[model samples]
Target: MSEMVIETSNLTRRYGKKISVNNLNLHVPKGSIFGFLGPNGAGKTTTIRMLLGLIRPTSGQIRIFNQTLPKHRMQILRRTGSLVESPSYYGHLSGYENLDVIARLLKVPSKRIDEVLGIVRLTSAAKQSVKGYSLGMKQRLGIAAALLGNPDLLILDEPTNGLDPAGIHEIRALIKELPAQYGITVVVSSHLLGEIDQMATHVGIIERGHLLFQDAIEKLREQNSPKLLLQVDKPLEAKRLLQRAGLQVSMDGDILQMPNQGLAATEDVNRRLIQAGISVYRITEQSRSLEDIFLDFVDKEGSL
Candidate 1:
């Protein structure tokens, strides 16, 4: 089993009279890209700020790298790099100079500055003033600064906020390479579900400050309940044949959901439908998506 890089036990945070984060328990394993997903105003930023010790939690505990946060903040931060919301850069200075300043603040070696600039593919534009750089270039500069410490873990909040499709793809590829090539743990938050589905090894989904689910991406995909969607020429005959086979099948217009049964049994039902003068157009395994599952759970809990 991999080590637990981050753990929160009933983590809670509040602002004045409103509770911004409520009982968020997150476990992010070492060497995995954990996708932190939530709707806007869902307290994702609040949770991140707490993790970095930038803000104090009203209740609960947070542990990073096996050390309690806020108390050993300096210790934890030494091995962590983060980019939250927007990238900060000195417009008047060149990209190289911007990173040079951060390197000095972190007291990193002078050679390390060049290494990170190369890592984010910003070396070519390092001499250009940041004021004339594109949005993507500025974002890359922020990433360069984050890698300055060669931290074991990188926390990025909406890293692709203002990038074009090509820029987004470049960032995605870089993020995917971090864990495998450099042995770094990545915690990324994004509103794009499709991108998260493609990039994450594990996922933690939250809604309205409550943690809805946390598990491996593959495990979540496997948890989808099995159903069959079929298109047939003779919908009526197909329905009748399935019912006669002792299968509880229902038809909605032209589509049908095969009854819960073994895979072999389901195949047999399909064969019967075809043989009963029904021309089967298509047969597909139906599964609920992450978004679908998230909404269903939220609605179910809200009704209680």
Candidate 2:
């Protein structure tokens, strides 16, 4: 079995009367880019801090690399690197100088600074003062610092928060390479579902402090059953026809959606629609987006 890099059991956190994070469970597999997803104030940052032993949880347990946090903090931290929210940098110092300081703090060799600078594509700007660096450059520098220790696990919270399109793509490509090239397990938090959907091998969705789902990206896609959209001139009659054919139909504006259980079911519905004289403007299969899936789950649970 693959080793679990990060696991939490019934994890909960509260701020006085407000329960910031309710009973939550998560399992992040080793050597995978695990995407942590949630809207604003969904406790993503808090949960991350707990895993890093930066803050104590209100209840439940957390284990990283099979060892409990806070208790085995020193050991776990030695093998982990993180940049939460925003990474701080000294404006006057060169990129290399900043990493050099961190290397000294980690007791890493001075030569390691050059190596990290190269990894983040900051070698060219190594001698340039950070004061004139662009937002993307600064972000890259932070990433370089995170890699200074060559940690086994890398946790980045909103790593692409302020980048433009090209910068975002650059950072994304770098993140995708971390697990494959360095054999490092990565946990990334993002509100951009589309981006997460593209990069993550595994995912965890949280809403209103509760964990809605956790599974492999492929498994999640498998579970999102395709539905058929019937765009017709007469939606009401079309819906009735589909229902009469033993197909469950949902009314959305001028569209009648029915679950596509199989090819036979779809063919049966099409035949029925034709027989009913329901002019089908369009009949298209619909795959729900991650945002759509998340909202449905949260609203169903009354947690939205």
Candidate 3:
């Protein structure tokens, strides 16, 4: 089993009467891409700030790489790299020069610049002026700067914020490759479920200053109760047949729906419907997407 790289116990942060983060207990496994998912104003940035010790938590604890925060801040930070929100770059300077300045500040070897540039696929545009780079290039450059520290853990807050579809795809691909290629544990935050669905190994969902869910991506999928939809000529009769077979069923227009019990159950439903003299036109199992699950969680929370 992998070690816990990030763990928070009742991590809370409040601003006067407004609570930004409410007892968020997050667990991130080592060598995994942990996607911090939430809607806007969900306190993702606030939690990240606390993790970096930029702001003190109201009351709670944070452990990174098995080291407690604030107390061992410098020791923890030395092994972590982060790119928060918009990246800062000297537009007047070339990409290479900008990285050179950062390297000098960190006192890292100058030769490491080229390696990072290649890692972010910015080596070809190393000499290009930052002012002329595209938004995607700038974001990649920000990631490159983060990599300059050669840290074991990388924290990125909305790394693909304002980019076209193609640009988002590029950044996602790069983030997915980091853990495998460099052995870095990544903690990336994003508001879009679809964005993280493609690359994240584990996901933590926060809403209204509260963490609604946290687990492996596959485990979340298992939590989704698959439903089978049946379109039949006799909806009422089909529903009756399914219910009589000890299956809970519902209906929507001409469609008969029931809990998906797997392939055998689905086949049994079809056969049973036919045996009852009901004509089954279509039997489709609808699986919930991550977006669907996210919205449901948020909506449910809002109601409570």
Candidate 4:
């Protein structure tokens, strides 16, 4: 197992009688882009706040950088940087000036501000007032500010919310580069499955304050294995022939469906079917989509 930069055990939080976060365990491996995914009001923000020490967990333990939170809050924070929702910035301040304010607070050298500006590709707009900047530019500036501290971990909550396609692409590209270019571990939260699918190496899914899945993105994909699909003549005959020949096959209208055997096996099956006078029009593989898998988890867990 890789080193867990952020590990939680039975972490839970409540607001009055409503439980915002049920018992949860999250493992974020170092140097991995961890996608924190959940629906709105699913306790994603609450979990982030607890991880950042912005709010205390009702019960459970949080360990970041191998140090327990709150006890080492300042120390953990010093090596951690975060941007939750829209970044807080002075509109009147120039991009550089805004970063400088945060830099001063972190006691980071002035040159580090320039470095982060370059990292976020905001150096060209360094002197521009943030009020005049585009939404994407402001997001980049927020990321620059986060990078100013040169922290090992960066957590973002809905960082791409309310952005145009180009803007979203820009942020996604920048985030995808952080791990390899700067050795930064990122914990980015999003409700969009496609966004997480495109960027994250690992994923944690939550719904109604309950975490449904946590593992490498590939593992989630493995849950929905592809099935062989075929459109052929006399589907009933094809199904009967394949099944008798030791291949499990079913019919969906005029098409035949079965588990996707390997290329050679499929080829052998195809040859046998052709010999049996069943014309094969089209052969393809179909699998349940991630959205399908996600919905399955939500539905099944909700009922439980």
Candidate 5:
């Protein structure tokens, strides 16, 4: 069995009458990019804070690196790196200088500074002042700082927030490579389902302080069964024929809709329709997008 780098059970956090996070359980496997997803005010940040031991949970437990949190906070933090929301950078200092300051504070060797800069592809901009850096550069610099400690797990909260399309893509690519290239487990929080679909190996979705889904990205894709749409000479006859053939069928106006069982089933359907003298005008296979699945889960749960 694969090791779980981060795990939480019934984790809850409340601000007086307002419950921020309600009974959340997260399982992040080692060396996998785990995308933490939720809408605004979905308690993602609160959960992250609790994980870092910056705040105490209202109830439940947290474990990281196979040890319980708060009790092992110092030990866990030594092997974890994080960048939450916006990163603070000194405007007057050059990028290299900023990292040097952090290295000195963390007692990290000076050589590790250059190595991290290269990892984030910021070596070229190392001498450039942070004030002149683009938003993407600044974000990458923050990640480089996070990597300074050579942590086993990396946590990032909306690392691409407030960036343009190109910046978002750059950060996304960097994040996708971290687990494979650097052997680090990552927990990235984002509200954008499309972005998460591209890079995350696993995902956990939260809405209105409630967890809606948590599983591998492929498992989530499996939930969205493909459908076949047929335009035939007689929609009613086609629907009835498919139903009699032990296939679930539905009519949408002049078209017949059925589950896309695969090539053999499609061939069977075509053969049966042709035998019935029904001309098949067109057949289209439609697969649901991740956005569709996300919306369905959120809507079904009524987590506005």
Candidate 6:
């Protein structure tokens, strides 16, 4: 197993009467873009706050870079960079100037500013006032600030929120390249599945204060199990016949659908249907969309 860059054990937090984050175990592997996914108010921000040591967990522990939080907070923070929600910046300051301000605060050398600006593709616009920059440019600038200290890990919470489609794509592409390009492990939080789908190598899905799923993106994709989609000449008859043979079946208009019980079962069904004079026009394996699987997890389960 790869070393975990971030791990939490039964991490919980509450505000007043509401339990914002229930017992949650989140694991983020080193050098992987781990997508912290959930809907709004699903404890993503609250969890992030705890991870950054901005807020204390009511109970449980957070381990980053293999050292416990609070105990090694300063040491861990030095190797980590983050942007939570919208980044704060002085509109009058140029992009370079804004980063220069952060660089000085971090005690980073001035030369490092140019490198991070280039990494975020904002070197050309480095001299322009931030107020004149588009939302995407400003976002990249924020990322550049986070990168100023040359962090080993980057945590971004909703970095793509309220952006145009083009802007979202820009951030997504940048994030996808960070792990290999810079050897940085990223733990990005988002309520948007499509954003996470395009960039992350692994995923942790949270809902109503509980972690419902955590695994490689491919594994989550696997959760959408393939089904045998059959376009039969007599759809109703095929469904009835299949069900009678102890096969659970469903119909989609003129199609018959059943669990894809591997090749042997599929062949047996085909043979049985053929023997019954039923015409099987087509046989295909279809899996549900990621959105469908995601919705199923969030709506029906406490964990997966």
Considering lDDT, which of the candidate structures 2 and 3 is the better prediction for this target?
3
Candidate 1 residue pairs that clash: none
Q: Where does candidate 1 stray beyond 4 Å? A: 224-226, 259-267, 279-289, 294-304
Candidates in order have lDDT scores of 0.87, 0.87, 0.93, 0.93, 0.93, 0.92
lDDT string, candidate 4, 204-236, tens digits? 999989999999999999998779999888788
Q: Which ten residues in a row have the lowest lDDT in candidate 2?
A: 295-304
Q: What digit string (tens of lDDT, one per residue) describes model 5 on residues 58-107?
A: 99999999899999999999999999989999989999999999999999
Which lDDT tens digits does candidate 2 get at residues 1-304?
Answer: 7689999999999999999889889999999999998887888999998888888999999999899978899999999999998779989999988888889899999898988887888889999999999888888899889999999999999888979987788788888999999899999998888778878999998877888888898877777788888888788888877677676889978778778778887778877878888777788898887678767766765743
Model 6: lowest-lDDT 10 consecutive positions = 295-304
Give candidate 1's TM-score.
0.91
In candidate 6, what are the lDDT values of residues 65-161, reduced to their tens digit?
Answer: 9999999999999999999989989999999999998998999999999999989999899999999999999999999999999999999999999
lDDT of 1 by residue, 204-255 (tens): 8877788877989887777667788889888887788888777888887789
With a 3 Å backbone cut-off (N, CA, C), the pairs that clash in candidate 6 are none
Q: Runs in model 6 with CA error above 4 Å? A: 240-248, 251-254, 261-272, 281-285, 302-304
TM-score of each candidate?
Answer: 0.91, 0.89, 0.97, 0.96, 0.97, 0.92
RMSD value for candidate 5: 1.2
Which pairs clash (backbone N, Cα, C closer than 3 Å) in model 4?
none
Error of 5 at 127 (Å): 0.4
